[model samples]
Target: MEKEEYLDLYYQMVLIRRVEEAAAQLYQQGKIGGFLHLYIGQEAVSTGLISARQPQDRVITAYRDHGVAINCGIPAKKVMAELLGKTTGVSKGKGGSMHMADVSKNFWGGHAIVGAHLPLAAGLALGDQYLENDAITICMFGDGATNIGYFHEALNLSKVWNLPVLWVCENNRYGMGTAVERASAVSEIRQKAEGYCIPNDCVDGMDVLKVRQAAEEAIRFVRQNNSPFFLEIETYRFRGHSMGDPERYRKPEEVKKWEENDPIGIYRNHLIAKQIASEEELDLLDEKATKETAEAVQFAETSPEPPPEALFEHVYADVS
Candidate 1:
């Protein structure tokens, strides 16, 4: 990667981390409502994978989707507003944290139901193929979601149709409270794709460079053969599944172990070691991200709530 690219990736990761941290803080302060899923440690997976996509390409993911939305060009302020249930929100305050959608940017939505979005992603790919567009659809989900019946159905259909879709399983070791081993009979997520005769691989989801390489390869394959592919990104989430989770299921030391391999810290050290960014420059980056997050929060707070009549406005389509 070029020096500028490395710097931009660092900035993107920092922005995602700071925004999610701020959202969590707001939720705790009662400023933001609804289910809040923080993508604290899984920054590399989204940043790396989404960076590989073209502007015209579409993305869909499960509820832990704030990072993807931001990566897809949605403003941080609008995302925070959505989490706060304000009118300025991406979903116009109707979808809250778990359902942010910006059709203009082609970020379809943040679906709350596990594995439910897979088929939708395949359908999106089908549309692109039918139109003779070269766009690819990247469908993301948690490791737990891989066990759902819809996942199997979606994969089968995607493979049968040879749709240009990449099924990414962000295997963060655990699904909600249940460990992957406990929840899945076959824990090898990548192998699951073979049943549908789709090519697959496992990626180091914590390393942005590794993720980018893997995603690029997958994208190339899907575009070349017009076939669906699957990737199991072996990553970890720093926070509990949700705000309410006490996380008694995992030990503190286990969390600390993953923290040591944090994508942000690892990338920062790599950049400095390679003389790409000075310590002062890195500090400035942190400062900038912090300030940006603060400004986004202020914007969300000052933005007006959705008008009472807006409830019915977006709900019903124009029939006349």
Candidate 2:
């Protein structure tokens, strides 16, 4: 890849890491309420794949969505504001952390239900297909969502109709507190797509370049053939399922092992090895991300809270 592309990927990954870290701090300090899911270790998955999407392509995902929205071009301040339930948020502070939606950016939403967004993703693809548009839809979900019935139904429907969609499974090995072995009959999540006749591949989720390559191929396949494709990225979450999770299911050694393969560190080393960037340059990039994240926090803190009367505004739609 070109130098600028490498720099862009690295920068975005750093931005996401900083943003999540800031969010965690804010949540602990009681500045942000709600069940916060931190995307600390899964940075490469969203950064690489979402960055590969076209302008008209739409993205939908389960509750772990701040990273996806950021990668889709939603301002970091707006995401932070939404997390803080500020009126300036993307969802007008209504969606909070688990329900950020930027229709203008084509980021459909961060659906709170386990596997519910899968069908909505298919519907988006179907609409594009019916309109004869070349745009595609990318649906991202965790391994836990795969076990849900909607996952299978959506994939089957997409396959039958030949809708342009990409199903991306961020297999982080545990669903809530249950390990994949304990939860899934077949631990290899990519194999599930075979039942729906969708071509699928598994990539090292810790590697940004690898994820980007797989994303490019998946996007190409869906767009060219007007069909669905699946990608199961083997990654791990450094944090618990949620902020208060006791995390008794996995050992500390396992977490340590994965931390050694940390995506940001790996990519930083790759850039240095390729002579594309220096350690100093990368550090500067990290500083930039940190600065930006602090600014986002400031923006969120000062943003106004939604009024009580405003609650009924978006609750219902005007059919007329």
Query: What is the lDDT of every predicted structure here?
Result: 0.92, 0.93
TM-score of 1: 0.98
* lDDT per residue (tens digit) for residues 1-320 in model 1: 78788888888899999999999888889998878999999999999998888888889999998999998889899998898888999998999888988999989989999999999999999999999998999999999999999999999999889999999999999999899999998999888999999999999998998999999899888888999989999999999999989998899999999999999999899889989999899899999999999999999999998988887786557765
In order of appearance, the predictions have TM-scores of 0.98, 0.98
Clashes of each: 0, 0
- Could you tell me the C-alpha RMSD of candidate 2 in Å? 1.0
Q: Write the per-residue lDDT of candidate 2 for residues 123-177, one digit (tens) a residue.
A: 9999999999989999999999999999999999999999999999999999999
Model 1, runs deviating above 4 Å: none
